[model samples]
Target: DIKPIEQLNINNLINKRNFRGIFGTQPPLSILEEIDYIIVSPGVPFDIPIILKAIEENIEVISEIELSYRLSNGKIIAITGTNGKTTTTSMVGEIFKESRKDSYAVGNIGLPMISKIDYSTNETSFIVEVSSFQLEGIKEFHPHISAVLNITPDHLNRHKTMENYIDQKSRVFLNQTPNDITILNKDNPITFSFKDKTPGKVILFSRLSTLEKGVFIEDNQIIIRNEEKERLLVCPVSDIKILGGHNLENALAAVAISYYAGIPIQSIRKALKKFKGVAHRIERVDIISGVEFINDSKGTNPESSIKAIEAMEKPIILIAGGMDKGSDLSEFVLSFKNKVRYLILLGETANIIENLARGQGINNIKKVASMEEAVLFSFNIANKGDVVLLSPGCASWDMYSSYEERGNIFKSLVKDLRR
Candidate 1:
């Protein structure tokens, strides 16, 4: 059965298209008797009774990404990580577009891989942002260049363990060969460990240290090294406008993916200089009474929120807490010390965050009931040189349909707030 079960919005299809809905804890075995194979969405748990039953019966299972890989004619550049996937994928798409190549940034960045299949050609490039959920269903799906930006503790509710999550992310490299390129993060230990498991020639990107044969920052300049001992200076670090060290890693990954995909260094540099970053990702909303309002509702995990917090230059009035993802929030709370002046919380995990914040000696906390209330509360307490940030450390599903909706509401609320 669907976990929430209320997302069954198939009424139009059911009434006009004769579609059927069948689900239960244990659906009839007869249902699987005629099924040749099963294609499960990433949201469907593998441990479900029907899925386990199908496996026991020797039925094949694959994911949408696998299906798209089999059907599409384009080269794929798959990106996966706990964070930075969207920004990196978007940046790669812009780079390809700047180089005048046909590209579509699909998958977990909001567009479905299957929906864009008809638009693809041999010359087309698919810049896909994959997730552990989607990767769990992949079998033979492989990208020409697979980049794992970084892996941290996330989605523990479904995977239940860090190793399983890492294994799922590693599936992006399953079918690559020596001719393909795999880009990884040299700073994150988890993603750096994936180098040994990759079947292809591995390149790396780092914000922390220079690399012998990959993309890295050295002397405030982005550089790429080749096996021939050749080094190409890409751009200066100040050329990138995206905030945070995490975003620097994203930019590095995008550069590696785009450069290997045959985009000229000049085109990639032009795109990097103009790209301001994606929406709801540390996006600056407005300045009201000298307080900068920032929307980072897409920071749906503690690790992502920590990056947003670290990026702040001023004392922050942070708006956090949303649907719990079973993450250990102690670190999320601990990151608040020294930077955050006031913590305004809402949604399901507000109380949990309050307790955790108290334990960390962060006492300036306020609990509100709605996004509007949270914004007003933060506005009332914020001063000049303070930032009002909406960087929830949990998913938005508790009070909104998606993070985009949550971020939109926050932006609107901040826009309408009286001075």
Candidate 2:
């Protein structure tokens, strides 16, 4: 009297460690009726029929993040946004380390948070880079300090609507109380509008505006004003190694979060000056034939790719396109038209991007089926002072294991070219 699992085979059940016995087809009515909990993977859509069925059956559904949160005793400082999450999370972890605290940065930055869980101590802190998919299925996944850096139009294909996407991102603060801190990007209109959404104490970080309680840049100094004390922590912005106005905002967010987590001002300053950045996010590879090659494979959204393009001082041979996540590439058209001297489109979104470029009257666009072809094409067209940048404004899942793998390939190809 067992029902079978639908759309899944024996291997799937075995891989999932479902030892209750999986039938070839839908399980028997008796087995289906007794089901209690359903764990959904990030790859499984929330709107899936099986999830709806589970809900109808009064079964509890949860994500891996929820499970991790339940088991973790460490102070969690979770980061989420369409972009810059990894860099900010890494920077915050560095700040904690500089303060001589036991801290580890993990999670969606490709290292699982569960893998870093130390059973030995209760003093360790975790800085996790979370995603919307991970946030979507949570039940009680609350972090001690949560920061939504910024949210743009992204992952629409999975969420099916922008509102749903924003709702998912807001889950980062779902279970927090007033004692917890919620840091937000005040400059991001979308994140700013969510000010009334969370019940936790709000701390705002901005690059364009001043905040009474959070961090901001004013008169060339990075300022952290204490709303409770009316005191200030100030440092020069030039001390930060990461470039771009966007990164300035990221640094501000990290500083606010780490400062609240008990990291001293001097430790924060030391981390800011010494921390370079996370890999594959505007990562400079090498100068081949005098053309600088940057592997920014983590810029999977148009907003992030635009930031990478904006950070470029030299003329760029922009490598873009991948599995389209239903993001609007039109947002980057002006940046590409101005900064990019050549466009090398790759992966599933190539034709769509190429058409968009052509529609915009851009003629220097070229399509290549693989990264090697794209690199060679870029190298052929790149001048001595120009840069060949792999800042694909789409996901790398279509062609490689992960964004890191895609970035490594670009680095390897660029190194081979140098040799």
Which model scores highest in lDDT?
Answer: 1
TM-score of each: 0.95, 0.91
Clashes of each: 0, 8
* Residue-wise C-alpha lDDT for candidate 2, range 1-419, written one tens digit per residue: 12345434356646788477545544444554767786666776767566777777878888877777778877888899988898998898888888889888888877777777655157988888999999987888879899999999998999989999999999999999999999989999989877899878999989997776788888888988886756575578898778688888889989999888988899999989998988998898898778999999998888999999999999999999998888888877667877889988989899888888888888998888899999888888888999998999999988986788899999999988866
Clashes in model 2: which pairs? 2-27, 2-28, 3-26, 3-27, 3-28, 4-25, 4-26, 4-27
Q: In model 2, which range of ten residues has the least summed lDDT?
A: 1-10
Candidate 1 lDDT by residue in tens digits, 354-412: 99898888899999999989988888888998999999999998899899999999999
**How big is the positional error of residue 41 in model 2, measured in Å on the Cα after superposition?**
2.5
| Alpha-carbon deviation at 269 in model 1, angstroms | 0.3
Give the Å error, residue 323, model 1.
1.8
Model 1 spans > 4 angstroms off: 1-10, 13-18, 23-29
